[model samples]
Target: MLKTESLPVLMLMGPTASGKTQLAMDLYDSFPIEIISVDSALIYQGMDIGTAKPTSAEQAAYPHHLIDILSPSETYSAAEFVTDARKLIKDTHHKGKIPLLVGGTMLYFKALLEGLSPLPKADEHLRAQILEKALEQGWPALHGFLKQVDPKTAQRLHENDGQRISRALEVYYLTDKPLSLLQEEKGPCWDYPTLQFALLPEDRGWLHERIARRFELMLEQGFIAEVESLMRRGDLSIDMPSMRSVGYRQAWEYLEGKCDKETFIFKGIAATRQLAKRQITWLRSWQGARLIDCQRSQSLSQRVILDLRSQIEKYPIFM
Candidate 1:
């Protein structure tokens, strides 16, 4: 009843605790689409509770890809995700199914959508030297260094965004090239005709309240204990990407005795709120994304399904 030419790949994106998983499952029930996770943390093994990974039953019913595909000890990069995701998309299409990319990591979405810029791989020696300098000279000096070299990028990043600022400075210091230049040089390629959706609440306070409640739930769900297991592994350092996760970082502090249990939960909630704020800021910049308002809806899940149904009807994936 419909043409295959108009069946665009769908990307369902949202912040953590914004019901992306629920919405994706609802869509899965009605459509022949495989859920491909876009979250960075969900890729790791033994990180189920904190990451809010799908249960065995849910995954079995839905057939999600890119979850529990690796261990926390193994580092998975955005480059690898893009490569694997592209392969999955092609393979799924070949099998007469659509690919539905879903999750919270905006960078992963950017990697798949715009294509990765050809920046040199991180130089460990240079990164270490930069880290040492920052540790000795403080984060402000790193920010000043970045300002001197790549002022445009510096202006966009805040002084307190020490991680990104330090990384940007290190890249320039190592390669004598601005990271922005790499992005600009590699023009964006639309890899797929994509339909994007974001689940959001019209009221900010409602979403914030949801975030607070969810953080409480994570604590009850033994989030700290999960992080304890990872710390005991003795493989992760502060420099590792895994250390930068929301609840994981707080739990690390608790393990170090830098913060108590209360502080851990408090800081985790605060950090999650900050993360949601950043996600909202990024989502606003997305082009042509259909935003479903979750506020004032008695059944948020049903609303999402109806929206997806409308989109699928307009651009049917199966001919």
Candidate 2:
């Protein structure tokens, strides 16, 4: 049996359609590892087809934690993810298994690794007021206001990204402190030994092709019907976080007559590629993460397992 203290938390990160799920399953078959999903979309129930969530049979064979635990209407933040992941990591360790956190959500990984700033909680009144001002002056105007107060963060975010822009302004409104300064003050909370791996395709063109193909396959697999089912419920809207997921957003817009069929497919594929691009950018910024070329000829699972064994051998607790 492997010693509990010798096992490290394994983080498997990659862009969408980079074969992260397949590699994670291979690792699960080869080792005593429990999976904790790190994806934002997978947490919501009934968001299966669009999110490309694990099938019922796959989930049955290899149970994953923190997936399908929330309704689409409910909100989940990076802070909540940190709390849930930390608890799951401890639990998995106690059960003599290494926690294998797998997904493409870089924000969650960052929050779990580096602790969040002690910013004040979301204020509904303030949020509403901001939204009202945004409706009148537009998000770009609000972004300009943010640039005056927190230029560092404003430079990092896009003018169209209302969610983050509002949050940064909210922090300034509540605490009179820049969001960047608060984030810098906080230290990493997770001190345990961790082995981080990122799956990156050497050829960017090849990865883009893969993303387009995968999205087409999703549409063939009743993706539009899935979105229609959610829409018929009347409780969900395109503005909601769940519906705002890349492919889902395009599909929702198409169904609402905002776009034509051809445009919908093109937009969906383009959005997925953009999401992958953003994920790759985040992975590049991460320090000390081992990069796995997804295009390699050798079996990725075997290579990863061998690396894990080597790491275990060097661990002091194993000696």
Candidate 3:
């Protein structure tokens, strides 16, 4: 069995379209490692196109955990993620392989790497009520209501972001506590040694261009068709977490008769660019470890493998 002192974890993070997934797969091919995804969007089943989840072929190539294991209908919170990831990390360590955590979900990574304060389970009734109100009153009306209850969270989130606004209000109603207070008390609580690496593209403009291109590629790959299938199910609502994801949200509008194909393409790319921007800002705030500019790094695979090996050797995980 691997002791906490011996089996160090490797965390590979980066913004969307930074080539982290391809690099992680490359490293997996070279090393004895198991991947535990940190992506929030990838957790939902049937959310393949937008979340960029590894295809079945890729999973056959390398073992990946915590991905495509949940349905959008279920409530998967960060607290729940931390619990499962820590267990998976321990399990992988027992099998004598490195637990390689990979993805772009900052919240999940932060909660897992640091620790999360205990928060009350979401009041589903309250959540449903909030959504019903939003459908009738619109996001601005709901946002206005949140401002009355929790001005701090309301100010931080945009008025049109119905999902987050509802969540914040639901938290307050459930626990009688401000979401901000819960955040301050949470952090990575483990003593296990961990190495964090980020694959950053040096050129912002280049990354934005790549983001736009990726959305177009998804379109060509039948992104809308995927949404149409879900729409036909009628069980998947736009309020679901998976549905709120970047490209899926815009495509959902087209499926709902809210937009034409042209508008969907245009808005999808714009939303993806915005998501990339948020990801970049989130990565900057991460401290420690290494930052590789994947855009400029020659032979990123070689460099990351060498780096991973060096970190393992330097740390010397003991059993």
TM-score of each: 0.79, 0.83, 0.81
Candidate 2 matches the true fold with a TM-score of 0.83
lDDT of 3 at 148: 82
Relative to the true structure, candidate 1 has a C-alpha RMSD (angstroms) of 5.0
Q: Which stretches of candidate 3 lie over 4 Å from their true place?
A: 125-188, 315-319
Alpha-carbon local distance difference test for all models: 0.80, 0.89, 0.82
lDDT by residue for model 2 (258-310), tens: 99999999999999999999999999888979999987726787888899878
Residue 301 in model 1: lDDT:
69
Better of 1 and 2 by lDDT: 2
Give the range where candidate 1 is weakest over 10 consecutive residues by summed lDDT.
1-10
Candidate number of the best lDDT: 2
lDDT value, candidate 2, whole model: 0.89
**Residue 234, candidate 1: how far off, in angstroms?**
1.7
Candidates' RMSD to native = 5.0, 4.6, 5.3
lDDT for model 1 comes to 0.80
Location of the lowest summed lDDT over 10 successive residues in candidate 2: 310-319
